[model samples]
Target: MSNHELGTVQVYTGNGKGKTTASLGLALRALGHNFRVCVIQFMKGSSEYGEYKALEKFENATVHLMGRDTFVNKEAPEVEDVELAQEGYEKARESMISGKYDIVILDEVNVALDFHLIEVEQVLELMDIKPKNVELVLTGRNADKEVVKRADLVSEIKEVKHHFQKGIPSRKGVEH
Candidate 1:
């Protein structure tokens, strides 16, 4: 029962919360099954997040933060943001092809695409070349239509209700 038999493309996207959380949950579940996972965070560049600290306990999981800690202006992203995302995408593509990991998560990559930090064509190309044995997960808001069409499983989280709407700020271990 190897995890490498029929890996598929999964996309978690929308305006709702938990897209990243859902992807992380999948990584944890995969790790529980002794699968190696690699998570490439496109627009997060800090170790301050709780998931960053918690995932350290799993030797089979690796996380790469590839952006500044500050916010990115979607209308006009900084050069650093673009560069980091490009670097992260390159690493993710390499990992997918390396066959060293059973699951590869490109966290916030959809947002990166929506904000024009990276092109959809490149992402689509990566998906095209992805090895059949490597599960690919892409997460973030505003996932492109083409990406959705390409994914084997697409989950669009709808924000029917959220604590943030009630003015509750993002809490550690819950929203980080």
Candidate 2:
């Protein structure tokens, strides 16, 4: 049940929800086995999320929020957005190289890449340098084909239906 073996690259991407949710679910499972986990959230720095608050209960987990509460324009991202994402990426890469965590989840990294905040080649290079036992997870919509091609496992969460279409806002403990 423990992930004590070689860690593989896992990607969760698509035009749907549950990408970050799925990665966090994995993090929770990893914690059950006493694994050290780091969650670096990109473009999602709001402290109001229930998950962010709940992460305090896990002693072996660390969550880094590197974004503002404001929305970022994908077509033309602001300078501050780019800077924040770059900082997040640097911290994420450092964490992975330090061998300080068993699982490193770069939440919303794919979106950052899609918005041109980071380059695909940069991520690809990081994959090459990752520690053998470090599990690297990238989550967000619009994942590059190159990323999918390099990952060991790729799960696309297709949007079959969503409450947002029904005018239901994000609820605490569920969508937040």
Candidate 3:
């Protein structure tokens, strides 16, 4: 079924492991119904991610990688990092306004904002201009308070326990 009728602002944020996973699950559900989905991943540039590889098979899904593989210096990000984030933000704006997507996911945008790679005002403006028929999903830790206040749904996935504490590295299929 076409999902042109869908619309809502959803946020997945917190210090948990499943924020991106949750959003990807939503994308999978939408794609199953033949909805057009756009994912703009901020602060993540690896093409080796499992979701990236998996989503490549969906004709209705588009994923944009917008950062270097190296971690951005939160206190003083590189010029390239800033540039990529801006590019990603512009792409997200275009996707939302183009009316070509049923769902748009800004993965890790909250962290982009937290790291000062993008301004919170710009994100707020994007929210203001979102078409009534477009569904927006923002995923990352440290979501801005204003964003949370404006969202139609906000899910905070707090980390109760994780294997990372045991010094286990990210697994291939599970984390990447």
Stretches > 4 Å off in candidate 1: none
Candidate 2 RMSD to the real structure: 1.5
The lDDT for every candidate, in the order shown, is 0.91, 0.91, 0.94
lDDT tens digits, residue span 17-119, model 2: 8998999999999998899999999998898898888887899889999998989999889999999999998999999998789999999999999999888
Error of 3 at 24 (Å): 0.2
The C-alpha local distance difference test score for the whole of candidate 1 amounts to: 0.91
Q: Which model scores highest in lDDT?
A: 3
TM-score of each: 0.96, 0.96, 0.97
Candidate 1 — which pairs collide? none
Q: Which window of ten consecutive residues has the lowest lDDT sum in model 3?
A: 1-10
> Residue by residue across 1-176, what tens digits does model 1's lDDT show?
24559899999998898898999999989998999999999998989999888888898888889999999999999999999989988999898998788999999999999989999998998899998888999999899999999899999999999998899998887787
CA lDDT, candidate 3, residue 7: 88
- Candidate 3: lDDT of 176? 75
